[model samples]
Structures are given as C-alpha cells and as structure tokens.
Target: MHQLLSRTFKPTFLKIYNESHLHNQKLGRETHFRVVIVSHEFNTISPVKRERLVHKSLEHELQAGVHALSVIARAVDEPLDTHTSPPCQKPVV
Candidate 1:
C-alpha cells in the first residue's frame, strides 16, 4: 500500500497506519488503512480532489480486498495535523 501511494503521489511525507485490527477482520490481514500523504502535487487541489486522486491511485488494491481507506491528503505548504482514524463502529457480520 505504501509503495502504491509513493509511486503515485511522490509524497514528501507519508504515513500509513494499518488499522485492520480496529475492525473485525482476521488478525493478520492488511485490510484497512489510514494514509497521511503530504505532497507538492496536492498544491491548488481541493480536499475532495486530493482524496479522489488517492482513491484513483489505489484502485487496484481497493478491488483486491482492501476493505477501507481513510486518506488525509495535504499540500506540502499545509501544516500537518495530528489526525488519526476513528475506531470501527460496524460489527462483524
């Protein structure tokens, strides 16, 4: 997942949190993630567009069993936030 985002965004700062454990998935599965990506590529883009770009870049992984992706996309000039993913509310089916 990191590799995919890196390739597409060329981010100056990137943090990926494997939050699958927060959800009711198999113990070791890499199914959910929170990605904080800071890149010059995001300059002038709206927040929604930045997220769409991240989603577009991860299309393959999304189709291949990545259950959820929470993206925090930022322009290089923007201040970083102490953002974290919220715990999953949906229970195991």
Candidate 2:
C-alpha cells in the first residue's frame, strides 16, 4: 500500500499504520490499515477524491487482503497541528 501511494501520490509526508491488532477479535483477515498522507496532489482535490485516489492506487490490495482503510490525506502546504491522542485499549472478544 505504501509503495502504491508513493508511486501514485508522491506524498510529502506519508505514514502507513498497521492497525490490524485493533480488529484481532473479529473474524476475518488481518487487513485493516490507516494511512496519513500529505501530498501536493491533494491541494486541489476534494476529500472524496483523495479517498478515491487512494482506493484506486490500492485496488489490488483491496481485492486481495485489505478489509478496512482509514485515510487522512492532506495537501503538502497545509499546516497540520500535531496532537497525541489516548492509546487504544485492547478489544474484548
């Protein structure tokens, strides 16, 4: 997925997180992921389009393994405030 995004979006700041552990209690493949991508390509695009672009880039992964993806796409020049959120607790089965 990172490779696909790198080739297609050429992001300025890209962070791909494997959040599969969060869904460990669920019955399915461990394919959940979260992507935080900052790129110049997103400057003129809408949020929906940004997601579409990412989906398009990872078409194969979506078909093969990835079950859920949460994306945070931003423009290269955008100012993003950093904040630390609370850690996630393990899900009870």
Q: Count the backbone clashes (under 3 Å) in each candidate.
A: 0, 0
How far in Å is the alpha carbon of 86 misplaced in model 2? 10
lDDT of 1 by residue, 1-93 (tens): 789889888999999988999988889999999999999999999989999999999999999999899999999999989487777798659
Regions more than 4 Å wrong, model 1: 90-93
Error of 2 at 55 (Å): 1.0
TM-score of each: 0.91, 0.78
- The regions of model 2 sitting more than 4 angstroms off are 25-29, 81-93
Tens digits of lDDT, candidate 2, 1-93: 778899899988888877776665365446888888999999999979998889888889989988887788888787754333334577679
Pairs with backbone N, CA or C atoms under 3 Å apart (clashes), candidate 1 = none
Q: In angstroms, what RMSD does candidate 1 have relative to the true structure? A: 1.8
Q: What is candidate 2's CA lDDT for residue 7?
A: 86
Scored by lDDT, the top model is 1
Go through the candidates in order and give each one's C-alpha lDDT: 0.91, 0.79
Model 2 clashing residue pairs (backbone)? none
Q: State the weakest 10-residue window (summed lDDT) of model 1.
A: 82-91
